[model samples]
Target: MRRADEKDDDHVTELVSRAEQALDELIKDIEALVRLESPSSDLDALRRSADLVTEIGTRYLGVGPERIEIDGRPHLAWRLGDGPRRVIVLAHHDTVWPVGSWGDDPWSLVDGVIRGPGCFDMITGILQAMLGIRLLVEDGVDVDGLTLLVTADEEIGSPTSRALIESEAQGCTAAFVLEASGPGGALKTERKGTSNYFVNVVGRAAHAGLEPEKGVNAGVELAHQVLAINTLGDPDLGTTVTPTVLSAGTTTNTVPAKARISVDVRVRTIDEQQRVDEDFGRLHAVLPGAVLEVEGGPNRPPLQASASQDLFARAQELAAAAGLDALESIAVGGASDGNFTAGVGIPTLDGLGAVGGGAHADDEHVIVDRIPGRTALLAILIKDQLSA
Candidate 1:
């Protein structure tokens, strides 16, 4: 009798072989998507990609997608199947790069790698997902109970779409985020939570040249606050408190009463997040007349291992059966929509996109050869859940 691992590999091989047949068409679809620049903040540009996705979904899945507008930007949701147990396939269509930033031709294929704005970071994932689902649909795989959410503002912290994502994820069996895979194609099972804070200092203004002692220096108070914020970081615990953006003083000669600092906080757990929040709240301005005001907390909760391990185990088993290398999960400091689902106690698996690197960088690209296998893996994973 054959061993279980070998049997699993054979199953994966069959699925991958089927998906590999669609490689050329998948590349074409991905290229088409990358050419359409959909920066997160541009409503018009975002709609262009949104329309393209609608066209593709209608053509391949034989169904139309619902366009939901949040904060004036549109998001896409396509529900497949009618089963009671549903799976949430999470994706984002918007990218960080703005138009005209990638020179004339951002979309290009060279030496087995595809380079383009948002190609590796996500556009490729979206296309791959469509192709994967197409394979399942064509093979008559039962897929009557899945939800695909392609949001428009993920690059800007999902300010408007979080509620929609949470609502859709509610009652779903699991969530699979189409974020790019880790180095060597490892899946992400744990992710840090993101919390943003704005620290504003208010003080009385006076002429710098006259009565300097009477003017309360908000900039100095801000500096003190920055120092205190810096102390909140605990590297061993994977928690970081960074004051990313700073602004102070209206003019050069003025005493400069108002100052604002934007802080980015990443934590590995809710307790750690609470600890940092408490510390930030307890911070007091050093200047006697200066007052400190803090705003924002825990935008995306952490995807802890406790909430995601089961899904990760299942994915690893599926990967092994597919004849791929032994699958392992890693924790990343960056947060994704997966965090939101995992935060709600759902088993979530992430980083199931193309295998490559250079996300959000000038050299952003995805490995051309790896697309077929990854697509097959995702399709099988989705079918596995839907079948159950």
Candidate 2:
């Protein structure tokens, strides 16, 4: 009974001690994961990433290769030990940057920073979970049940992967999403749901030099749609519509007959989604040529504050006990696979990834020195949560 009164860090130190010895293997694992070019929409890249993940899962976590397919990609799940409480450690094998989108060679650790596609948003989080699970197993700490889920469609709003995430999360006790934390490494608490919509316009075409009245410019029609979307911006409500990509011309002389604009939407609540729908619908009335077709919805379920404060309070307590300077946090708008498990009624923690910048840009890099600390933090969290 006296043991139950002890502190979480008492168990944390032992797990960290063992994990410290696995640093080299951890780096190797991260490098290998980053090397696989698994853009969520690319079939070949998804296959390669799946094979690597399955190999590791089978070799270390005691999970087999065969996975039930949901959206034509393998949603690999592995676990160790069984207890009444089941928690999912969520991450994505898919990357936002596709093959050839980065530097000449996108794989390798340069001065401790692993450079490659999918390193931050978020293959590194996946590695952290793998190593954390390994450390827990080595320490003989029996967590109720830990399910590590790596999916292939998180980068593209998870349309093909959402059903599988929900199914896997059905009876789990809690989840920890591995999305990158805040700019300064603070963890995430609440996140707004996101959507990607498309608007297409069609107009008559004629020779600009010969017949001016005979032609209608599709680009001009698309411009009207863009302006309509701009009017929906509510910065106060965290609702926004950004028309990020547009294509409208085949040649300089021709009046464009077709144009398409891709819009990215973010909403903090379900009610905001309705507002976005209403706002977007107005585009057709303003521009009759616009044959807008919206696709994708609610990428990440708004990561509502945990129903029970025990989960967040417990996490804050553990971090404090572990000697982290302070329990830092802020609500973010980004989504992660963890959102799925938590949305399905599991207590989910997030922002457990390597400290880094340039996640989806050319300058993407990880803080080399922070690897050990982040790895140590994860090891501690697992042990603290599972220790009886």
Candidate 3:
């Protein structure tokens, strides 16, 4: 006569063992996806990648996902089980690495470490979701009301898939994001919101050595605006406003008539976003003859910590039951599709993917040994959420 908690622990152990046995299959699937480079900017590569994802998903779940195409890009979705409580799993198949960026060897597994483009960023996460569902079905768990979305354009700000993601997340009990784990496999409980702006200045041009007084000097005005934008960030409050790109003057001697500045903004709260937006709107040209135009605004809202509190707690308990390392949570500065889900007032827990470093860099890789534990943790979390 085992206690309820003990029984739960045994169940988790069984699931973990199952995942361990499937490790080779998981690596094979990851290798296949890594071999096909699907950069966000490449449509043809995205199509091929989507096809491979579909094939792998169908093999695992015994069903094919509905291919949703927007702007010639393919996003895949699957609606599984049926119940009152529902959950949406958010993932993206697109990577930051372009085709041929991996050099000659696209996929490599060395000493239990797999390295390739998109392997850590998200491709492995997509397969992990599929495998988690498969594991649940094999164990005869009633996984009702589970939806998985694999978008094609998340790396490029989800230009084509934001609306669809929101729609899928509506009325869900929880949203689990598989965007890779944080440092040391920690879960991302919160993420900063992102905003982008481009400041364009126009002014009268004149010969610098001759009629300098007749020119408004847009370059000078741009400098003033950059200094003003720098004041918006409050480090204590986790707000950052950075002028990333700047361009002014066409030649060394010419009185430049045009200048542009690209600003990057991140905030931990909606109020900060509003404050920054209002301040940017109030910007005016310092030069009397110069005119300023601001473009772009708040992109993805923040993933507030409150939205993930409950889900993350459950994940920790489930991780312990699964006999894995103690779980930790982090608040990252980067934004993900989880931000959109949390923005819609749904409870979302992110960073439930692979345990690896170098997300978008040349050394991107995944630890082969940790795959089973991570997959098992996801499986148990989903099972518990659905049951609840």
Candidate 4:
């Protein structure tokens, strides 16, 4: 067993070199993908993107992906190998930026950088995952089982696709999310969970000029609740309660009958999640004759450190073996499909995508030279996990 393990490691090390050699083809793959603008709300655009992915998967894996449509948006899934042990590669094709936002041309390769609406945020990672699997298959590496899931609605908080993602994650040994890396190529071992709330205040409306004294002001009540909600943030615990969107009043003059406020809650732990949930639930309308109702909580649970440490350690080892810089793990406030998998007790490693900045920004782009190394790192980790 030891001898076979050593042989597999050597093979994987060589496979890393092979991955580097395949850089040109991989870059073209990424360019092709980034050119397709698949916004979360655009079903036609997302389907077109899915078609491209299906073509690529069929060309390399000899089997196309299974398309799953949720609320008219399409998601793709490809299962490779039939071994009992399974690993999932979680990715999304939807980008936050809309089309034509990248100026005249969204797809431009300039001096070792690819800039576009979705280039760095995740198109690169999606391609890298395909390339990694291609390399593994072409090399005849022993892969137990691998599932590649590309969803279409992640950018807008994954409202429709969380069930599908969690279902696929049920028995997987590990999961890897291909979200773009942070500055300087940092991976993510922990991510804060997002608990969103829609706080609605209902109060009696009366004419401002005619019967102002009879009106119960919902807007004023919402103001007080907003202040209380803002106070829920604790910098020490990395918990924040921010009211992002507020809507009130049918007209400016009347004391608004209904006021709605959206609260964004982020927490670093499940304990914090519960605390915030309970606290938010306990909130009551301060003003007499007004009622407060809170809806929605914890869209994605935190990818706790304990659930990711082992996978992150393995990633670091593989990075070192591939002659790359030591991989660092971080805790980010933004959540991913990784949060779902980790929340379900799967060891999940995240941010294994291209090394770049400007996710969801017009300047969004990926470091061109880093693609091969990142792809190789993922290939090595997948190969190593299969060996184990």
Give all candidates' CA lDDT scores: 0.86, 0.71, 0.91, 0.86
- What would the per-residue lDDT of candidate 3 be over residues 1-388, giving only the tens digit for each residue? 8789888888878877888898889889899989989999999999999999999999998889999999999999988855553889999999999899989778999998989999999989998888988999898888778998999999978889999999988889899999999999999999999999999999888999998999989899999999999999999999999999999999888899999999999999999999999999999999898999999999999999999999998888777765788999999999999999999999999999999989999999998888877888888888877877
- What is the number of residue pairs that collide in model 3? 0
**Model 4, residue 250: displacement in angstroms?**
2.2
Model 4 score (lDDT): 0.86
Model 3 worst lDDT window (10 residues): 78-87
Top TM-score hit: 3
Candidate 1 per-residue lDDT, tens place, 1-388, comes to 8998776567668767867787787788788888888899788999898999888767767888889987788899998766664898999999998887898777889899999999987988887788788888887787877888999998989999999899889888888899998888888988999999999999888888877788898999989988889999999999999999998898777787999999999999999999998988898889899998899887999999887788788877777656766787788988899899998877899999988898888888899889888888888889888777
Per-residue CA lDDT of model 2 for 156-248, tens digit only, reads 777787887787667765667777767777677777667677887777788878994677788888788778778877899888888899999
TM-score of each: 0.96, 0.87, 0.96, 0.95
Candidate 4 residues lying further than 4 Å off, grouped into runs, are: 1-13
Worst 10 residues of 1 by lDDT: 319-328
Q: Which clashing pairs does model 4 show?
A: 195-298
> lDDT per residue, candidate 4, 80-116, as tens digits?
7776648899999988876666666678888988888
Candidate 1 segments exceeding 4 Å error: 1-11
lDDT value, residue 141 of candidate 3: 85
